[model samples]
Target: MTQVEARDSRGTEGSPDPESGTRRARVRRAVGALSRPGPWKRGRLLATPAALLGLLMLLHAHITDRGGLGSLVESMLPWFGVFVPVLLAGALWRRSASAVVALLLPVVVWLSLFGGLLVDKSHAGGDLTLVSHNVGAGNTDPAATARDLTASGADLLALEEITSQARGVYEQELAKTFPHHTVLGTVGLWSKLPLSDTRAVDIQQDVGPLGDAKSDDQKLPYNRALRTTVATDEGPLAVYVAHLGSVRVMPRNGFWTDSRDRNATALAKALATERNERVVLLGDLNGTMDDRAFAGITAQLHSVQDEAGNGFGFSWPAKFPVARIDQILVRGVEPESSWVLPATGSDHLPVAAGISW
Candidate 1:
């Protein structure tokens, strides 16, 4: 063979193939680009904020509620995810590898906290179907709201914010479908099964200074919660219907929740003493399950929506719901399905859940 042919057959001793050399150069360029100061440092502003967002979510429960700020944040915690995309866009625009990588922290934390809620976990059958609604006192058409509720085919219905004037309207409208019913002040429960041992639950009775100042006569008008026993085939089921006091944000008082928080505490005490093995609490609690104020209540009962619902099941401000303040919580039963009902005449939409004994 010729010298060139012989050399070619033997291959080059020290020289790499052109393709392999090109690959090595490309890899080195990539490594150098990533290792450079600019790529790592360009979006420090964005990266820091992204990391803080993740930390905020990771430690939201530890946040202080001295001025109700913690509850406010926890109430809207899920919405914080909206920032992820915004930060991601900024990272891409800045070509920031660090910023992009930082985003993974929040994304993972958010998914860890609320990812299961996004999936459809509802099942088909249940022993009971119950619905709860805060039929607004300002609702002009209680009759129409009653009609809409009856169409739900629920076995039990709990109504909150029932006005003195509309009590007769609801009682009359719902009597045919739900034969057994009780209305104690502003909250009421109507059931297809037998109801007994019904009593008004004074959620504001022990609300410290504010409660002490009010006389029994004065407090009667503000009674907005109740407890009752519904006789189901499975046995006596204890039911609590409540409309906790409203929260307000005033200029002087940061997120004012004194009334609601007190009411929640009183209601929790009532729940702790309950002797019934199976219990269901339905109402417009005026706060989400995540809020620390409901820690007492949430500790004993589990949210049906969280257990067996599709998505977040937001039910307030009927126009555009962003939170699941209207809740159906149960103890000693399995949640088969949970959902948000369509808007009625009230500002708040209804929420429903089906449970099996």
Candidate 2:
């Protein structure tokens, strides 16, 4: 064997016959390769899990409701950005340029979906002031609710879930600030300005699910919505105060009653035909503006809080809000500021917004 062959085979001098120097060299090279450490494979493993966590956060937004299975997770959607930035930081720590670059896609996706909200203001437009609330039907202190709502100093007030029994009490309590008022069954509208042509809007319900099925009440009608013309100083404005059907989560039945669905459709139709250019809609929709159930309303009017609200701005269970079922929506009017007021005797907190022409 040649000297080079012997060296390559044994990786040493004079180890044995037929050990060529070339073979010894090859052996030495193999030993050196085995002893050296490799690049960070563990880092690659972690990137996948971190990426998945980000995707799950986005999915949670679609199915989450205050009463739904992912309610808690949904409430936390605002904070997901904090985690996303951290995930990218992990990739940076691992010195994985590919994973780091990969994160930009998710970052872009999240930013596109929610980035607008991160801005300080919702939009730039002429301003109009309005307020909305769901005074509990079972509330015992109608006068107190009125007092609290009046103190909000809103230009227009829209109320919902008012019972027949408490109608007079509310009227008396709010008469000083809102002299112009109208009530259509359980729902009502009150305005600081003069109200004219006030009428009940039939929201496609013959009768809600709670009533007699065989009776005409069971048939869908459009009376669930109410509209009135307010003579503002600038010009006459059309206002709609509607209380869409309430949603429920039952153990045996999933989202049992859909009276609200029919009501929403009817409301949407009515809004579509509204001739007035400047329109304002306020009410307790029994669901969030983001919910697909309220698409009928969302498509027509823009929410004030979603545009300028600082936090989640939950208004239900006034004691501790986790979802904003009540809302103030406006079209052709600009909202300057929006916020939720302190709890009254009702189950929902009063929300108010300031606006200008």
Candidate 3:
């Protein structure tokens, strides 16, 4: 036989091809390594952290609030996702099957908690458009803030942190858009519809240990919540406007939310006893709805943002908002759409929601 014939015969007889042999060997090695028990035993360090993160998200409510750590974590619970990618990178670098499997827990838990918020659930049109803003007490240009609010075309407006000095500016600037209005201490309600049964809600700001020491005059400034009735064509809609106490993070005390928690409890109680069938709460709650401290309030009213907003709708620290502390929650009404307004002259961006009867 000729040389070419001999080469064909050798190929047909399965002569060992170095490249093909190398490829088969590599495949076998990869399969063997994956099937081996050694990979499951590797990356214990990565596995431990991944397991802890999953448990933290799963049992965040069970975590103790001894140093207000529970509240702090819950407030930023959604952000816990930042660790998942880091853990995944480590798992990939280590090529540990166990670490990759462990990561499934946190991924599932986080998605279960906040995945819905990532979707857009809003629809067009509603009976009333309500806007709530903190309006910052230190706002230098109250007139401009009021104008921005008026431009929102809201049927009802709730303003919190309205200082006595700038109150008149807001009143003057917003009067044309919102004809019927009431200012109770620092909290106020402005509406195109007639308002009645307007009164200050004692959110127990002056009933606490330190608050008890203050006189009536001193307690006047702490009046940061109100209740009012807006006579809509549908019916008399009970409205609540509130600015819960500020939260602080101190080196010694950790997450200091005593004041805000007290206010939330008091507000929840008030909501529990509300006679009105249709209720709407608009405010700067000073805490996210996910925090356990608002369990009482959250149990009664569902957030419009959660129901109808496009995203998380975080409304605090307008320059770089990281949380949705400003809220419009409702009971006995349908939320049509929810959105965050443009930044005003305050620290908070206004939140608005349209509700139907």
Cα-based lDDT for every prediction: 0.91, 0.73, 0.90
TM-score of each: 0.86, 0.72, 0.87
Model 2: worst 10 consecutive residues (lDDT sum): 208-217
**Candidate 1 lDDT for residue 132:** 99
lDDT tens digits by residue: candidate 2, 259-292 = 6666777888999999998888888877666556
RMSD (Cα, Å) for all candidates, in order, is 7.9, 7.7, 6.4
Error of 1 at 39 (Å): 1.6
For model 1, name the residue pairs that clash. none
Residue pairs in collision within model 3? none
Clashes of each: 0, 42, 0
lDDT for 180 (candidate 1) = 93
Give the number of the best model, judged by lDDT. 1
